[model samples]
Target chain A: MSFHLGGDKRASLAEAAARVGDGALVALGGGLCARLPMALVREMVRQGRRDLHLVGSAHSIDVDLLIAAGAVGVCEESYVGFEQDLGLAPAFRRAARDGSVEVRESCCATVLAQLRAAEAGVPFLPVRGIKGTDVEGLHPEYARMTCPFTGEELVVVPPLRPDVALLHAPLGDAHGNLHLDQPFVLDERFAHASVAVVATVDRIVPTAELVGAGVVVPGHLVAAVAEVPYGAHPSSCYPGYAYDRPHLAAYLAAATAGGTALDEYLARYVHVDEDTYAKDVDPERLAAWSGSTRAWQELFR
Target chain B: MSWALDAGHAAQRSWTLDEAFVVALARTIRDTEAVFHGFASPCAQVAMHVAKRTHAPDCLLIEGATYAVDPVPVFVPPTGNDLALHRDAVYRMRFEEFFDAACRGAVDRMFLSGGQIDGYGSTNVTAIGGMPHPKIKLGGGGGGGNISASIGALTVWTSRHRAGRTLVADLDFLTDLGHRTREGSRAELGYTGGGPQWLVTELGAFDFDGDGHARLRALWPDVDVDDVAAATGFELRVALDGADGLLDPPSPAELAAVRAVDPLGVRRSEFAEVELARTPGLSGVAR
Candidate 1:
């Protein structure tokens, strides 16, 4: 596939989210509740695009916000929940409970298998194990095949090529080369499997200065790179900041209260611009959390 | 590299339910084993790191961060699973590679938890009460649901277990299907190995006995037999000879070790932890 930036790759978060267009199957990076593209996610909600499909193996805040905003129409994920630490996600829980959302619950393997198939440009990926589990019957539209070599039944997942891949990285260049200190965690696969990828980073550095550290998402696959500092706030960006626990706690508190409380939170946080949204949080605490984390994360150097 | 600090303050505090749970979970980890922590697993992450630093120094610890640093740091994320938790790990592994290891049975043990757990070791991390659409929809089978069917053993860390919420007569959904894929079908699906080798809860610890039913192996010090039995909806199998086998409380050394990695009290956050502990540092790396 030929890679094109449509022009200059450096764009705003709004511009990157706008490039995704409407009704696109979006793939979010990060596992559980880390490294999510919260800036872009909030932008999608701010723009009010409905009838969208989400594809990712593990998700937390990114999926929850999308579900709460009533923007996601379908989701193909391993599972969507705040880890044991944060309890259950309220907006997503309520939406799924009411049947307004269509969720395809999978073991993490199936989701990875689908992404691998898409990255390989294949129709299906044959995976071992999970043939006898509920993964068999979850998606009737999907099928299971017999492995030709061993004649053993294998779970075959359909290719899940996303229209756009949105993720947050620790560092990136103006040309869209991303440097993430952490493991790929399915972000590289998403970049390969998606038609276009939008990355939000802590900073856009000079390409010449991005030495020693390897580029995780190559510039060619990236459609745009937005230098949005604290882009993954409320979520952690390795080598940069940690998740805002107090902020997440407040959001959870509001979400659990249900109804108007969630709306009030979105109005103050998600609906506002990056600057105003960030102001809602104490700048000192955010700096300290990220500051304490830098030494441990930067040991890669 | 950041220098190690004194872990003195954290040691003096009493071990809470979450801390005891961490020690119990850590004991299950054997040396020279490969372990993985799945989604939303804070308690499990702490246990793996604790064991890696102490008893099982050679154990292969894997998580999303793909961290591979020598002499791991006490990198704790305030929220859920983060790469920082895997700080000082000496290798970078992708999810696909981990999946390959799982399918090949290269993994020895893993940590798992769900919205619901039954007496037979089947867990429901998916929806509750109904299907397609349900009364409650929690996060569905992360890696655990598949790990139950693929991995060799599971160490479930459940912080809270109420009658209707967790311990139940029947699971609302079977996200993780171990040897007991169905209630009566034990490893009939060709998947072998005992399921839920160590099932640790807030009240006690359990293991699947010979007949594939949950056997109560140990209980927390504070709780009595009635307290545990009443909290459970199903008939629990207690260890014979009247020895409740109370879990060994976290030694000062264990607390110091826990404080080293978790100086911020992330573990304590499960039940309202404080940032700065004033107590003596029973830990090795004093605060």
Candidate 2:
């Protein structure tokens, strides 16, 4: 993995999004509507990035928006749907059905194993169960080999090294050291496996303050960092805010309708700068997320 | 265990299909088992909670999206990964840790559902047609393929069975392995878990036969073998007990526990509008 040692690694939102080149394999760092890098995602849409391949475990609107914007050509995620809140992701469903996007379906454990292999600098990793299903047949690269000690057959998956890892955390330093809260699904592993890591955080605290938050990702592992408050708006960044269900519902309605409805939505939201978008999302509503548990529960209602 | 019928009618209470469905699912888990259900599964989530509250208090209840262990939520939220589910959790399980534990066969039971479930218990959540290109793209099955083989037993459930599209003869693709496929049996393939131990649907509950095919074992209120045959794509085989398989709805205790855990009735979202409207408590429940 590549690293940027020592010096300040802060960059603007545009610059951070630009680091992810066209067609780069990006490992998005979040699982299902939490701590997703939405500010950077909007920035990439505004910049008109194209033909990107996204890989992740469980996801929702983040990947769906990119596919809706025609930025993604290959989707290797295990699950990409709104769990319980809604149903299937609208744009992703349409893209896959139309054969516009290549869906290289992989499971959560397999994806984790591949990333672990890359982090360990191993060629492949053996998984316990995945052999006796049709999912295994989709990936021709998966090889079956007998264990050396016990004659048991195992499925060996090749290492997955993403070109970039896009993440959004709660705290970070100018030197790019990240402090993510708990339930940081695979971001640390993503940092270790990817060639470069790009992140957006809610606050840029002092290095000491970041260390206190728990520096899960060291400065040396990161290529760039951007301070974008409410960077994960419409998706919760724990202890900061809760996901905006109304906003997400509006987004789904527009995406499901397609045509000019979706076009108008993109123009109104995705095309704008972070500051403008933030203003559009009423501050009072966001404040409610930071209140007691009752307020947090009210957001879903 | 035979539930006392007098206790049910004492409160002059009625039950919905979803509540009964949850009870049927909860019955699959033993008190000693560690059960897991994935994200977007409110029915299974409520079922696990009911089981823990009623018969299986010692059972380890794991949250799907958040991986919280033995969580004591105030109420089941519509979303899976929120702090609502993680409240008062005994321990938070890491993403990889759950998979590793299941692989080692530490996890006893897991609830799985598919876009299409075949007679052999193989499921398809990947696509509708074929791979690479498909007529319809369902949300991919998250770790179901790997964990289905690793866990102790699988409780397969589906709400869309009445539509005649869910229980199919052949799947477009097999996302999780069942008892046996065209290639061979799961034992021959070295899978640790007992494939599909039970299949619970809106119409009835099914148990695997000697040959590992889904055989209808129990029918819900007013559901007969003909009704199940009409909905299922494959040939329906009834249990040898026949009419005796017609089972009672969930008892008053089970229904009360189900409503307590799911105050907002998040499990109702899993069923169709018609199904909800047909049931007394389901459609009129206050949000």
Candidate 3:
């Protein structure tokens, strides 16, 4: 069967984390500043699930928070600034000092390669271009083999078939067809590579209306769907709505501050419910702040 | 010449006679041997073109962006430094491994330019106000001016209106320091490579003096030193015997090669029409 009706769309992020299994390759949607499911990600960390392998592009604030909380076991790429979203020098420095995170090269490509391998039904794909750099030694799971003809070392990237994939979309129908104009990086690929795909949409429309609207993700790949209004909020859908810059700014300040500063910051901002946090944060406050607000602000603003 | 012919065929309709100038400059620099190009630089394109065509067919083209030698043309969609292409190369590397390469003397020649370069070959690509927080935030200088000053040799290029942008006084920010301020400082800092060698501009080229300061070396034919002096915002001291050489108008082949790599003419786009009109002679050279 292509459909399952085990969960409610209005369920909390913590409840969603319960659905994810151990060692499952999870692809989180959203860009460096887009509407990411940070609430679910935080719950995953609080639950202390080490078996899950996380991957994404740029640095998602949610990802950094999880890593900071000691919930993440391995990260393939570096975490950018909490404000500027440029270099993750500070985060990497802290991670190095703590010796908790394993910094790998090409987080996006490595994850993409795994998805590609799985989609192709191949055990491994021979990838060129990553031979000599630091990425090779970081992920021992992928071996480096030499080409007999050219004598060049090629990375043998193993297939990534995620047990479950979690994604957020702008809208969907009860039948589970997703629709989104933005957040189009590797969402489709992640869906195809996973055994089950769980998508959260902003609102649910009639299947006929969605089909006629030409915004669809073909019900075949999607296993379940949930309608969560204003879901993308602070993470933004781009062109649909601007990011909640003030909330992002506060998160960045707390994130980079470290020690009790980070803890207090997360408690006041991140840990709270979406409604309460939204009401508390005045989006217009970002307009008043001059200069580069923080790394995260650069992602959207 | 044979490589040029091959490149011509590869570029097809995009190849024009103007490319020869870039090709020639590349050849000139390649002949010098052991030249380095900075990240996301047009000079890198010229250097690579010259290396592939002439002296160093087998020369190691080191890149800060990516390590891979793309088989496709240099100007292709992804270009050379797309992280997707090079991610696997440095996979799993600790920060120390990358720093080791920079700390060591493995890097040779480098290319850099300052927002305001003074009589001394010093450049400032940093913020003008202050550190920790500046009133205006200029992007961080990649490796400070250390790469230019410490590398075996350095090449500096500026396309800005000389008089307005190029200056007389020291810069507000020290983007890249040409050389160590004090004697014996090089050894103290563990730097052993050579310092700034050539400063190329639309007007012509300049080089450092014995004390490692800028001295006008050569001017293009049909251009007078007075015009150059007028164009410069700073007081430029020309060498007593400074001579004028036909700044070989870029050969058709050289211009074609440069245009092929940069179709939009990112270099020329930086200049204003008023500036271009003021320097009619330089305009012809740019075209």
Candidate 4:
């Protein structure tokens, strides 16, 4: 692991995206459709980062968009579909099938175990299950040993140290102290385990305000931070805004249509400036979602 | 896919096929147990809600995405991660803490499904064909591999089991621990939890026998033994008592509980288009 003790760790979205080099192993910080760091992801796409290896527990558009942009070559995630909402991720499915991407399938428990091992500075950690299933055979890094105390056989996974972790949050300080929201899927673990963390936040507050809000990630653990409002546009940064269902539907339509349609979508959204993308997504309308319970419910309708 | 508008609680005559199937799913839950449902499982989510509102009120319900414990959401949202699902949650579980509890055999039951579920109870959510490149890359099993080894029981369901490629004779890849697998039996593998207890499908329900194979236990209305046998890829095994295996239709109370818990009819999305057309009030609902 690495530490950033600098007094100010803030950077532009492009600079934060540059912190993740080409062919680097990236730890995606959120799960499903919430706080997925999409602004930074779009910037990375525009910069043409290539051969990224993505590691996560569960994800959707963030990972799919990278693959669709031809930036990802290896996927180590346990799950990559859109859950019950939109069904499977079309680009990921196609890439995995056509042999464009390597699928090192993992489970949530093993991924957590690997990250915990890295966090503890251990070489490996034993996981409770995964034996007798084909998943065990797929991971050559996994080994079997007898428990010294109980003489029971167990599977142990090696520690995974990603090159950089991408995270999005509701609040963070210029120094990199972050107040992550709940359902903190694997963001805390990813922050602690990765070598460096590059993040985007809806707003960057003072260190005092951040500490008052309860800091989940301390300043020293983060490499860089970019204050980009509505950073997780298509995805939800809860208490800030709900996921843009219509935008996601349009994206799915374009991606499902084929390469040309997807490229046109990228040209219209990804290659644009942050302010333009925000305006196109209608920030005022998205901000109004949290005005009331009824408004929030109507967002999904 | 737009869900049919709720229409603000229109009158209905009979329960739809999805409601009947959800009641069958709820029957598998014990009154006192810790049950977990994963994301993308609308039927299981509705079943858990129905069971809690009706029979299994004390069951420790866990939301898949939010990880909230004992949440009393007004209705199940289309997406699992919304704060709507976390409304009135007694406690929110962290990702690591819940898995740690499952490793200690704390989770009593979990809901699981697959692209292919074999007679031995093994499931394949990993892929459809060979490894290096699969014919179809299914959504990989999120935590089923470890949870299946530690949880007390598993309730397997598949809506596409009606002559679809669901109940296969062999799985291309075994993604979860079952009664027995390519490596060995669960006892040999030292699995702490009992494997799949029931396999509920659109056609019928199955219970594992002493030999650890799926045996027919109940049939849905209008589904005969021949129909199930024709759809099944493996040789069918029936319970010792033949005619008694027919599943009883959902009672009025059970139907009312399902409707109350799922006012938006979110569970109807689990069915195919042909099946959705069979729904009572929301007939011809397009997905």
Looking at model 4 chain A, report the run of 10 residues with the lowest lDDT sum: A288-297
Model 4, B174-285: lDDT tens digits are 9987799987889998888998999988878898989889998876645678878888997699873422332355556778888877767778777887765554324433
lDDT tens digits, residue span A1-301, model 4: 5587889999999999999999999999888888898998999999999999999888889989999999998999988887767878888888999989888889999999999999999999999889888888778989999999999999999999999989998999999998887799999999999999999999999889999999998889999999999998888887888878888888888887867899899999999999999988886676666576667666776
Cα misplacement distance, residue B148 of candidate 3 (Å): 23
Predicted structure 2, TM vs. truth: 0.95
List CA RMSD, all candidates: 6.3, 3.2, 14.7, 4.7
lDDT of 1 by residue, A1-301 (tens): 5585554689988898898777898888877767889999999999997878887777787888888888988877777766656777887788778878787776667777788788888889865556555555667856767678876655677888888999888788888888876556789888988888899998888887664577878898998999988888887775566566667878888887868998898898999998887777653354453444564333211
Comparison by TM-score, 3 against 4, better one = 4
True contacts kept of 1: 0.64
TM-score of 4: 0.94
What lDDT score belongs to each candidate, Candidate 1 first?
Answer: 0.71, 0.85, 0.51, 0.85
Distance from true location, Cα of B191 in model 2, Å: 0.8
iRMSD (Å) of candidate 2? 1.4
Q: Is candidate 2 or candidate 3 better by lDDT?
A: 2
Q: Over the stretch B229-270, how does candidate 2's per-residue lDDT look in tens digits?
A: 999997688883432322345667888899888888899999
* lDDT minimum window of 10 residues, candidate 3 chain B: B76-85
Error (Å) of candidate 4 at residue A246 is 1.6
Report lDDT (Cα) of residue B224, candidate 4: 74
Model 3, B114-163: lDDT tens digits are 55666655665433443323343333343333234345666665655355
The per-model DockQ list reads 0.39, 0.65, 0.04, 0.63
